[model samples]
Target: MADSVQRAFDLAAEDYDRTRRRLVPGFDDFYRAAIDLIQFPHDSQLKVLDLGAGTGLLAAFIAYSFPQARITMVDISSEMLERARARFELAGERFRFEVSDYGVDPIQEKYDAVVSALSIHHLGDDQKRSLFARIHGALNDGGVFVNAEQCRGATPERHRFHHERWITRVRELGVDDRDLAAALDRMKFDRAATLEDQLQWLREAGFRDIDCAYKNLIFAVYRGIK
Candidate 1:
């Protein structure tokens, strides 16, 4: 699985956006909905942190949506971060990038908002739970944490259905069968937990008002207030 994951994204950074654009038609809308779920005040400025910010997809959207906000993009992969930094270079002083691991890092400062997309599922359940606690500690009072993730469905039948749907969607976009198989193999390592479980974790981490704001099969946006 590790080999497959390394191969799938190792040097495929150049084609990331192209592949996603073709495979995920409603990507922008999903991101928009996640951003809209945040109740940012109009008069006050915000410090927004984007974790596992692969290629800055969410960062760019947040920057555009909340121009007054100071945005920080964090990711464990340097190659992905390079692409993300390059993409948002024109945003000038409003953006910053950091290389960090979410579960292990000690979050020193607080943020008004925390966001992540298509990430976090890589971690096991315990790590995810710990990360939620860390995120709760990283936010100021009444701050928000939003995660758009790939979650496990309620039943194995539903999980299989979502997998088939994902395969169909990717195949429709002309992703090579070899790549698709490789991607699926890597995805098998994903210790994805259910949305209900994640919400419970958030609650245990002391976050309030936890809910899912958007969902498409396994993909959903989970939000909570700190």
Candidate 2:
């Protein structure tokens, strides 16, 4: 399943940004909301780690909004990171890129802020929980973690509804039926937890002041302070 998931994104990497930009109309709005909710230090140097930083979408926003921040963009897909690296070439020394699996990456350093978008849903519940703990540990005191995620609905019927809505959305974007089927089939193998459940897991992981800062159906920004 993991190999299949990786392959799907790898195959899509060449056109991922273009396809997403057309399909997900509100992509920038989501990123803006997530960024607005994050609290950073005024005069101190800030280090930010963007997990699952596909194509450097959110990283670009972070760079523009917080020009002084040192940004590390991490993802498991080399192809995606390659594009991300290219996107920030003009920034030069301000940004860094790394190919990493967030679930297994060791914590040698702490960050002032950790952000992810539309990525963590690939992991199962246990992986999600463990990653949250690792993220908490990776933070300096009073640091923040913000995740803009694809969440599961509260019930089976609601899940089906959200699934159908997403299918309709991608279909309208001209994604072929075959690709959409394959994607949905792969998702069926993994467990996507509800927003409430994820918030509870965050609390269990020793994060404080956790909340869902934004939501549009199954997509939400879950944030916490360490």
50-104 in candidate 2: lDDT tens per residue?
9989799888888777878898998888888999988988888878888877767
Worst 10 residues of 2 by lDDT: 18-27
In order of appearance, the predictions have TM-scores of 0.90, 0.89
Best by lDDT: 2
Candidate 1: where are CA atoms >4 Å away? 1-8, 42-44, 173-182
What are the clashing pairs of model 1? none
Give the Cα error of residue 223 in candidate 1, in Å.
0.1
**What does candidate 1's lDDT look like per residue over 1-226, in tens digits?**
3344434454666766666654553676678778887788644578988988878888877877777988888877778889988997777878888877765788778999999987788888988999999999999999999998989988899988986787787777788866666566657668799998999999999999987878876788989998
The global C-alpha lDDT for each of the candidates, from Candidate 1 onward, is 0.80, 0.81
